[model samples]
Target: MVRPKEFDERVALTAAMQVFWEKGYEATSIGDLTERMQIARPSLYATFGGKKELFETALRAYVELSLTYVENKLRSMPSVKASFLAYFQGVIEGSGGSNPDFGCLCVNTMVELAPHEPVFAQITEEFEARLTELFRKSIEGGIQSGELPDQLNPSSIARVLTLTAIGLTVTMKMKPSPSRVEHVAAEILTLLE
Candidate 1:
């Protein structure tokens, strides 16, 4: 017979996500996960497998949450331009304008682990592709509605916006001037015109 889990897996995974988000995969230790997750070492292993597997699971959760947020934000405004603006502003003012406090977990993973780890590379790449598709779909809606120029290539513009977002997320890690980052975001939106 098997015993029931003492703690909520979702809650424990969220805690582990925060730990991995703050400290990259290499920097985070099993002790850090167990301590932050409030679980014993054996329980951590039994529940989440090894540290790498736990990180992968945590990353997937983050990606799902992030994609949902992006989709909702993109659809929140009727105007595609306004939607993009809101999205960029949200990035700049993340949950009280402290987004740079940790930077994006997926982007951070891309920089820290993707280069050396094929698994991470694939995960981050899939994230980027999915994000780009969301942007592309939003842009297509604008074109269809006659809000944006029909000649504009949604695919190309989406790629540019996605890359810009990734770059901005990485730059935010440097704690640069908020105004400057906002300026870059503004310039990116002009691609729609």
Candidate 2:
């Protein structure tokens, strides 16, 4: 019988995700993953199959956690407008924390690999669609609660927020200024009126 490896899978995957997020998919090498993961090639292959599989796994993990976070926060918050602003504030706080230019791991994968990879394109599209739905739900809740005007379109505002998120992610990677992002987010939230 074969014995399982001693390393922690969660730690390894998180480390690999960070590397991929920082350097991107095409730029991240097997050596880099192994180095960051603190595991040998055989162990990595045994655990995740290979680099592409590992990257896919990492992307899925990131998406799941991030989506859950967004969902939980938006759902629990009292004000729809405050929920969206808090979401952007989370983004700003995260961006300024560790690797300043880390941006978003899933967003990075989408921009770097989705164009040439159908699977990645689909995954990215689904992620964006779900995000849009979250925003739409919040907007709808706001309308029902008399917090927002009746004439406002939830679908349209949701799409706009989704688009703004993509742009903001890229901008963070380039500039990584929390204040600037926060200012832009505050301005964007004014549309809630």
Candidate 3:
């Protein structure tokens, strides 16, 4: 009987993600993935099927990691306003870290492949929907708690914030200046009040 794979799946995926995130889907070769993941070609295929499948897996992994942290900040923070701030602050900090300046995997993939790939388009749509829903909930909560304007339309405002955040993520890749991101974030938070 064949033994199960020995290496950590998450670690391999993370390594693969960093490569894909840095180079994008089309630019990333099988050789690059194997080199970055430090696994043999057969091991990679055995574990992740193939290049396309591995890219999808990496995208899903990135989404899960990123969304979990955002959700936690939104749920645990003392106030909706603070929660929004914390969420964006996390993005700024995460993007600025020593890791590749890949912006966001979801955003990068959406921009690069969504036009030509229906599956990626659907994934991008879901990502946006989830982010919009999170902001909508927070805005609704803020309104209930008297932190936001009574007239604020939660759905509309949430869409605006979601798009703004996506714009920021993409911008971070081109110009990863912390001060500029912080300035833009300040303006975004002001909308909540």
Candidate 4:
């Protein structure tokens, strides 16, 4: 009879995700994953295939969780503008204003691995497209509700906002001055007007 696994896969995957989020794919070693995941190398291979596969799995989980967080934040306020402001503000503040900022896992992957790795490129690209769609829907709602000008182009504005978010997230990784970052975010929100 086959033996049952001793470790919890979800908990192990979460640990691996944290390791990857802290150290990019290249920088992370199998030893690092095994250690953080608290599983032996054989168990790692048996459970997750290998480092590349594990990274892919971890990244997909991060993508889903990130999108859910964004969707929930966007829907939190009745006013679309307020919702967006709060979303951007949450990004600026960095995980309830307590945790050390890692920027964003998807954006980090886009910068670190997407250009050379087709799989990562596709994953990150899909993430951006989804975020843009979310923004587009919210903007369309604003237009329908008469909160935004009818002539404004939702697609164009959504793309710009997505790019702005990407740029802001990358900038935040460098730990710039808080006031300057907030100023830049405020200026970006003016695009909604």
lDDT of 1 at 48: 93
Model 2 Cα lDDT, one tens digit per residue, 1-193: 9887789999999999889888888899999999999999999999999888998899988888878878987876788888888777666556324343788776887788999988888888999999999899999999999999999999999999988887877777787545666687688897788
How do all models score by TM-score?
Answer: 0.95, 0.90, 0.89, 0.95
Candidate 2 regions exceeding 4 Å error are 95-100, 176-182
Can you list the residue pairs that collide in candidate 1? 93-97
Clashing pairs in 3: none
| Model 3 misplaced stretches (Cα beyond 4 Å) | 95-100, 176-182
What alpha-carbon RMSD in Å does predicted model 2 have with respect to the real structure? 2.1
| Weakest 10 consecutive residues of candidate 3 by summed lDDT | 92-101
Taken over the whole model, the C-alpha lDDT of each candidate is 0.89, 0.84, 0.83, 0.89
Model 4 agreement with the true structure over 90-187: per-residue lDDT tens digits: 77878643233678889999999999999999999999999999999999999999998898899999999999888878878888787777666567
Question: In angstroms, how far off is 36's CA in candidate 4?
Answer: 1.4
Give the runs in model 1 whose Cα sits over 4 Å from its true position.
96-98
Residue 156, candidate 1: Cα error in Å is 0.4
The alpha-carbon deviation from the true structure for residue 174 of candidate 1, after best TM-score superposition, in angstroms, is 0.7
Give the higher-TM-score candidate: 1 or 3. 1
